[model samples]
Target: MHQLSLLGTGLIGMFYTQSLHQYQPGVRVAHVYSRRKERAEKFAADWDIPRWSTDLDAAINDPHTDTVLIGLPNHLHKTAILKAAAAGKAILCTKPLAMNAAEALEVLEAVEAAGVFHGYLEDLCYTPKTLKALQAVQNGALGQVLWTRSREAHPGPHSDWFWDPTRSGGGAIIDMGCHCIEIGRNFIGKQVQPLEVVCWADTLVKPIDAEDNAVGLIRYESGALSQFDVSWTYRGGMDLRDEVAGENGTIRLDHWLRTGFELFTETGMGGYVAEKAESETGWLFPVGDEVNALGYVHMFRDMFEAMDAGTAPMETFYDGYVVNAIMDACYRS
Candidate 1:
């Protein structure tokens, strides 16, 4: 059994706990932590965790927990990683490991030096359709992947911190571009180094300092190009789509827009329809199982199973660092 010290009482924390408890048997959230005492208590009570604390270190140092799942804000990632590594605990961190490449490198070095198992929680790459497509690409179903495109756009994030440049780093790129960039790496090849990045970002719609809409192109050493576009100005619900073109064939994945299940309610469902849904009254796209649909189920399975087998999971801290580097380049360009 893998006992986890879950950090943060936010949306990501909730999803991670749901996947660990509701789906994965024997995997338990031994402890939960939140900056606010009330949130910590509520999260622990809601998830039935044995212990809860507002002190991050106390939670990480829990003797019963062997792993630390970090779902905290972007600015807090470095502190959590360093503390978790120092405590000699396996760490699983959320996307965009740090605010930028330099910070990401520092945390990555700390984890490597501490010799702890670390996994990058990039859930979109573990989606069922993306997993199958990755397998097919590895099997040479599509010759050499030459070009890939991944787009993830929605109204905006649910948290207030995400809009603050100091807290969340940049805007749309940091929020959603990390997902697209890593998806490209999986489709093309992680071994192929990204050569250059050119991006166009602007604060078009959102009343924020950071860019609200952005598009970027990452050129790889093998001449493959990964294209991505992220926006907070999108009016409709979340739109997630990906495309890969190789020498011989091509593949496409549309996750949210045309998700097999769709519902239209004239009045409203009187409940949450989906993540980042603009409206619950018009056409609602409610996921049957968010934990499964969001790729948390498969992702946790891979992380814990790899721990048992003494092997590295598909996504690691290195991948997260690389994505951060690409993001830094995007901002630079």
Candidate 2:
């Protein structure tokens, strides 16, 4: 059994724990950790976890835990990952791995040197819609994936750290662009090296040091061009969409906004409508199952299965590093 030590009590951490418990077999979050004692204790209790701690090291070094899932803020990713690596624990970390390509390189090297199983927790790349699109590409339904685009926009991140550039590393480009860049990489192919990048970004809406809006283009060695558009100023709700084109055919996906299961409610939709929904009493796209729809279930399942079989999951720290490097180039451009 893969007993995991989850090192965050935030929304991401909850999704990770929930996915492991309900979706994956032979996997459980053995320990929960939070910066706050009460949150740590409450998270543990809510999830029926055996242990909780306010201490980062104590939580990571939990002997009962064989795997460490780092769901902490962007700034703390490197430290927690380094700690987990030192403990010889299998590590799974959320993106963008570190503050920049340099930090991401350090993280990548540490995990490689430790020779531990590492998976990059890029859930957007594993969504059901994305998986199906990738399959169609692999099956040659879409010929050569020459051009691709992915766009992710929402109000903004939930936590305060995101608003701080020093902590978050960047603004919308780093926050949501990580997802879009990686999604483009998926369609363009990972093995094919990215040759060039050109981008434009500005803090058009939010008053922050980091840019709240960005658009980037990457050219692959195979002459494929992938473009990404990311923003935190989008008002209506979260918009997750992607398009892929090839010599043979094309594929279009609408992940969140236009999901078939839609409802119009006069009164608030009881409670939560979806991840980034602004209104409860309107035409809403209430996700049937947020965890499953967001690809947490697929992601965790693939992670544990790969861990068990001693194989690499679809996403690794190296992939994260590549995406960070591309983001760095985009930011510089």
Candidate 3:
């Protein structure tokens, strides 16, 4: 089994840990590090991890750790990645690799100098629906992909720090836009690189420095177009949808609304339905296994297997870097 050291005990970190436990028997969380000692200890005990620490170095440098997964804030990603690379640990980092292309380049250089396995955890690309859609596209069901559109919107982030542009980068464009942009690129195929980007962003709901809603368009080298919309002011719940149009056919995926299970509650279920579900007393999507459905389980599983095989996974730091660069350009536009 690959023993992993997890940095951060936030929402994403907790979800990743549970996913590893539930779906990946070949991987185990050996250590956990949180900013707070109490939180680290509690997470370690709750997840049955062997070690916990408030010191980042201790966790990354642990002898029992085979890999390090970073789920920290945007500004802290560079430091964590560099430390993990210096420790010669394989790395799997959450999305939006760095705050900007410059920071992403530093991360790229560090990992390359260390020659450690690295994977970028862009879970949306690995979701079942997305996978199926891409497969069909690859098989020429779409003929020639001419344009693609993807969106990810929610009321806002779970943490207060996300509101601070200094900590979390821009706003909705940098937050949810990262996912939509990557999804658009994935649907368009890797053979074509993004050549140009234009964006419009503004804050409408949240009283933050970052934009609450944003829209961007990307032009690929192959002359295809990718359009994306992201927002933090969206109500009802998390909305994830994508559309791809080609010369021969078209495909659409409504990730949240097209659920297999639904429940109507009068007094609420007294539990969670899905991520960012606004209410439990109304018609609920009631995601069966959110970790699996949202592709965290698959992401970790594929990452561990790729590390074992000494090969790059589907997504890597390079991919994350590209996404950051594109987002940087969009912000400038």
Clashes of each: 0, 0, 0
* Per-candidate local distance difference test: 0.93, 0.92, 0.90
Candidate 2 colliding pairs: none
Q: What is the TM-score (0 to 1) of candidate 3?
A: 0.98
lDDT of 2 by residue, 1-333 (tens): 889899999989988888889888789998998999999999999999999999999999998889999999899999999999999999999988899999999989999999999999999999998999998898899789899999999999889899998999999988988998898898888889998999999989887898988999999999999999998999989999999999999999998998888888897767878899989987888888889888899988888889889999999999999999999999889
Query: Which 10 successive residues of model 2 have the least lDDT summed?
Result: 264-273
Question: How far is 25's C-alpha from truth in model 2 (Å)?
Answer: 1.9
Give the 10-residue window scoring lowest on summed lDDT in candidate 1: 282-291
Query: In candidate 3, what residue range of length 10 has the lowest lDDT sum?
Result: 256-265
lDDT of 3 by residue, 54-81 (tens): 9999999999988999999999999999
Model 2, runs deviating above 4 Å: none
Query: In what order do the candidates fall by lDDT, top score first?
Result: 1, 2, 3
